[model samples]
Target chain A: MDWVSHAQAELRGAGYRPGAAARLVLEHLDREDCCRGAQEIFDALSTGGTKVGLASVYRMLERLDERGLVQRIDLGDGIVRYEAARDAGHHHHLVCGACGKVEPFADRRLERAIEAVEERSGYSVVAHDVVLRGACANCRD
Target chain B: MDWVSHAQAELRGAGYRPGAAARLVLEHLDREDCCRGAQEIFDALSTGGTKVGLASVYRMLERLDERGLVQRIDLGDGIVRYEAARDAGHHHHLVCGACGKVEPFADRRLERAIEAVEERSGYSVVAHDVVLRGACANCRD
Candidate 1:
């Protein structure tokens, strides 16, 4: 919970204060190596005896996302998943529709293609999300 | 409403019976050129004096998505936007983070890359969604 003081500093630099709930969320994200949704984070906090509302978890996550402390991923299932952006860098996901398994992927060639797209589209691409949905190997088996 | 019989036929062929509520959702999608969420469709139905619950709209949309009768797009803001897939072959979007404006886009190179990713990952790649978010031209102005 203390190593995330940097994340709180980032929020503070952006003119926002990160409180206990924010710390719990960041602590959860820091420990978690995979992407998680707000509900999952809220449930984890509640199970740990932390008193926080689901709405507050959502609000903190949204603010963290806006500050780039967390990366929001859309798995195309009406749910936005979040992972800590710090040290996670930029990446995409191969999400299994059947199992809800998310496999993070990165490719230099795809990055170049996305840059070319930004040039052709005339829109400054600040952030992009690529989600490939299909049956995983186990699911297909 | 009757013109969407073909859509219902597609659903039926896929072993799904398009109920009255499903028909209303399909009719709404048929007329909408842009993507919409379940609540929007539900509100629209209510405004037009069509009685359909929000949960029913959500259920129908999920069923339609499972049957490949509709395409769901996630704009990364925790909202899953749906568009009728009968005539909407395949496309991506440049979503305005500021105004929620979705601009559809298509790219041959990106499509090829997706195909390549499918080959490499061994996933069937049933469907893929690419969303680029940034400030729109109007927002920048």
Candidate 2:
């Protein structure tokens, strides 16, 4: 099943009713390719003429987080962002410090290093995040 | 020079007067192997009988951050943490989801992967952070 459908099912199975607010939040997050702050999500939903409260969005995100359906990200700018959790096609973020843009990238060598760390450290690593901060080509000039 | 001294020199070169509070904060941060929040730094200073206020600690941290003498980290928790920036002996964090314990680990393979990404993406990658979340050995029972 698709991520949204899978998440909706998980939410329902976990006793969540998956209301209109939740559905909107899920669809919005699904459409995003990068992590987005709660305010960003609310603003997008508002701009799209969705009548969802910011608080409801946050609550839905919290629920999604608790159910492991969303991954919370902090890019060191004091803003909490969330993205849809996935079992495959995992990626990391490259944040432009100058323009505050986020792009997603994946590297297999990094994955191998993480596996090595897990084996050596004897920790059951369930999740990992790599954030690269730099000036993008556009900003470098 | 050590990281603390180098930081102090950088601060002065940047027209910042390294006061007693700044010195204390730098020393405290220099001694910690893991990132610490301002409140934690204040508490540590207070416990050590230092009279530095939390606000002073925060101000000092801000100055250090502005000078690029410290690295700010947000580990998907709401708290923002700071560590002394190092030019060498770089490392990342492994955080325990169960106990909230954070341990530092380094892998040269990860560094290689980062270099590869920077070259391929043409990003002037100034800094990066890797955070692994999992159950630590003690918590894995």
Candidate 3:
């Protein structure tokens, strides 16, 4: 099952009602490869004619985060961003410092290195985030 | 010369006066192997009988960051942390979720993978941060 369905099922099984706002947040996050901040999500949903409040978005994200249904990412800025959590197709972020653009990229070699670190350090790593910052191709020109 | 001396020289070259506060902040950060937040740095300095204000610490950190003298790190938490930037002895963080302990570990394999990504992605990756979260040995037991 996809992450949204799995998350819905998990929420329902945990006796929490999956309301429209919750579904909207999940669906919005599901469509994103890069993470979005709470305010950004709220603004997007509002622009899309949804009436979800910013507080509601934060609450829903907090709930999803508690259940490991979403990954919380900090782009070295003050804002906290959220993306759907997945076991496969894992990726990291490339942030352009000049234009504030974010892109997702995946690499198996990096994953192997992380595994090696876990084995060597004896820390049972449950989550990890990699953020690379620089001038993108567009900004570099 | 060490990172502190190099940073001090760079600041001087940039036409900025390296005040007593800046020197104290540099010395404190130089002694730490891990990153620390501005407030934490201020508190530590105050506890050690220094009278530098928190705003001065922030201003100093901003100046150093502009000169690439320090690295800014966000450990998936709300706080922004800083550490002295170095040419060698590069490392990433392994944070224990349960106890909130952050430990730095270095892996050349990871660096190679990042270099490979930069080559393939066409991004001029100038800086990067990796943060891994999990249970520490004591917390797991």
Number of the top-ranking candidate, with lDDT as the measure: 3
What is residue B4's positional error in candidate 1, in angstroms? 3.8
Highest DockQ scorer: 3
User: Of models 1 and 3, which has the larger DockQ?
Assistant: 3
Candidate 2: CAPRI quality band:
high
Candidate 2 residue-wise lDDT, B7-123, digit = tens? 999988989888899889999999998899999999999999989988898898888877778887778877879999887857888999999999888888888988888888778
Residue A62 local lDDT, model 1: 84
Q: Quick one: best TM-score, which candidate? A: 3
Lowest lDDT 10-residue stretch of candidate 2 chain B: B65-74
Give the runs in model 3 whose Cα sits over 4 Å from its true position: none
- List model 3 lDDT by residue over A1-141, tens digit each: 888889999999988998999889999999987799999999999999988978889998998998999888888777899889887867999999999999999999998988888888888888888999898999997
- Each model's backbone clash number: 0, 0, 0
Higher-ranked by DockQ: 2 or 3: 3
Writing each residue's lDDT as its tens digit, candidate 1 over B41-133 gives 988999999999899999888888887778888776666789988553578899887787889888888888877887788676788888888
Rank order by DockQ, top first?
Answer: 3, 2, 1
Cα lDDT tens digits for candidate 2, A34-61: 8998999999999999999999998989
lDDT of 1 by residue, A42-61 (tens): 98889999888899889988
Q: Write the per-residue lDDT of candidate 3 for residues B1-141, one digit (tens) a residue.
A: 888888989999999989899899999999987899999999999999999989999999999988888888888777889999887867889999999999998888998998899888878888889998999888875
Docking quality level of the chain pair in candidate 3: high
Residue B44 CA error for candidate 1 (Å)?
3.7
For residue A20, what is the lDDT in candidate 1? 81
